[model samples]
Target: MRILRFRAFTRPGDPTSGNPAGVVLDAESLSDADMLGIAADLGFSETAFLSAIEPDAARVRYFTPRAEIAFCGHATIASGVALAREGAGSTVAFTTNAGVVPVAVSPERATLTAVETSVEPLGGVLLAELLDALRLETTDLDPMLPPAFIRGGNPHPLVPVAAGVLGRLDHDADAVLRLQDRKGWDGTIPVVHRISADRFASRNPFPRGGIREDPATGSAAAGLGAYLRQHGLVTMPAEVTVEQGAETGRPSSILVSIPPEGRIRVTGSAETL
Candidate 1:
C-alpha cells in the first residue's frame, strides 16, 4: 500500500512548482471504497491507481477527493513518470475509463497523447447560466475565442476571457457545482486569456472535484488545444504554451502540441515529492 507522490507540469530546475498527485503503483487488491479513501486522505486534486500492469500497458483509475473520474492529466503524467523511474521504459499505454492514453516518459519530462477530442458550441442559455454562476459578463469574454464546450478526455466549458480579466475570476463553489451537475462537466471550467499567438494563461475552477481551483490542469490544456484547432484559432501543427497556477503560487507550465488531425499532446516535467 505504498503511495508515491509527484509534482507534475513543473518547469525546469523548479521541482516544487506543479500539481501534486499521489500514485499507487499496485492497486489490484484495493476496492473502490479503498481507493476513494486513499484519494481523500492524500488531499490531492486527483490520484492515480494502477493495476493489471503489463510490459507496456496498464489499467489505471483516477480519483479525486470527492469521487472517481474518467481521466486525469496530471495524475497520468505523475503515474507515467513514477513508472518510468521504476524501469517501465520510455513509453506506456494507460487504459483509463475514458480511453487509452499513451505516454512517453523521459528523465526531464513526460508527454501524454490525449483521447480523441471534440468541440461544440455552447448554448446561449447554458452560457448565460455559466456566466451568472461565475459572476462574469459578456464583455469580459474574448470575442476571438468564444465560449464553447471542449472535450479531450473529460468535458470542460471553455471560457475565453480578455486579458487581465482572468485574474478577477470568482465564483461560489455551490453555484459552480450546480452548473456542473446540470452540464455534465466532469472536468474543470477553464477561464483562459491569450497572452500571444502561442502563449496563454488559464485559471481552472474544479468545484465538482471538491476543489475551488486547480494549480495545473493538463486535461483542460488538452481541451483548449482542441478548441483552438477546431475553431481555427491556431494553425495546424501548432505548439502552444499554457501558464497556469500563478494565482495559487504553484506556477506550472504546460506545453501542448496540436497536430493537423488526431489526439492532442500535453507535455510537462514531473518530480517526485
Candidate 2:
C-alpha cells in the first residue's frame, strides 16, 4: 500500500511533528490489521482509508494508533481531497462505522453532512465523571451552555469555557489514556475554550482512540453544533467556525452550520501530499 503523508494546517513538522495524515486511496487491499498497524506507525490523530465499492461511494474507515474510530473529520477531509485529486469530484457517500455520511467536494473545500444522532442531556453521573477526569470543576464551566453529551455520529461531552483559553491546551497524555481506557469514553473530554456567545475554539482529548488531541475534528464539530442548537446556545441560521490544534502546532479549521431544524453541517478544507 502506498501511503501519502501531508501536513495539515501547516507545512513540515518539527522534531515534535505536526499532525501527519495518511491518504490511502486504493485501500481495498489492506486488511484491518494492516490499516491498524499503519495507523500505529503514523501516530496521527486519525488515518483515513478509502476502499472503493463503486464509482461514487467507498467504505471509509478511520484508525487511530490504538483503535478504530467510528468517524473522523480530518481523515475524511483528507480522503475527500484525495478523491477529488483522483478526479472523483462528485458527491460521495462514505459508509463509516457510525453510519453512511455523504461528502461533497469542490476544488476549494469539502463539506460533510453527518448522519444525525439523538442528544441525551448529561448533567448527572456521566457529566460528573467526565469533569473529574478532566480535573475541572463545574464552576469553571459555562452555566449558560451547561454540560451536554451530544451525538452527531458518535458521542462527545460539550464543556464550554471562557473566551480566549483555547490555546492553553495542556494535559497528561497517559492520564487521558488511563481515563479513556478505564472509563470507555468514546469522544474526547472536549474543551470548549475561547467560546464567545456563539463562536468558539475547542480541543479534544481523544485518548480513548489512542489520540491525545485532534487539531481539527469534524465529527466533534458536528456534535458541538447539535449541542449548541439543542440547548439554544447558538440560534438557528447561524454558523460557527472552530479553530483547533494551535497549541500542538497543527492548526485546523472546522466550519459548522446549524439549520433552523437543528441539523448540522460541517465543512473543512484539505490538501494533497
Q: Candidate 1's residue-wise lDDT over 221-259, tens digit each?
A: 999999899888898899999999888778899999999
| Candidate 2 TM-score to native | 0.88
Instruction: Provide TM-scores for the models.
Output: 0.97, 0.88
Stretches of candidate 2 off by over 4 Å are 7-19, 164-169
Q: Give the top-scoring candidate (TM-score).
A: 1
* Model 1 per-residue lDDT at 55: 59
Residue 76 error, candidate 2, Å: 0.7
RMSD each, Å: 1.1, 3.1
- Tens-place lDDT per residue, model 2, 1-273, is 568775443323333323457877778888989999999998877788877646568888888887887887667767776676667747878899988888886644678888785666778876677667666667767666667777777677777765544555465677667767775666666788645655677778777776667766777788888777777776677888787777766766677888878457787766654
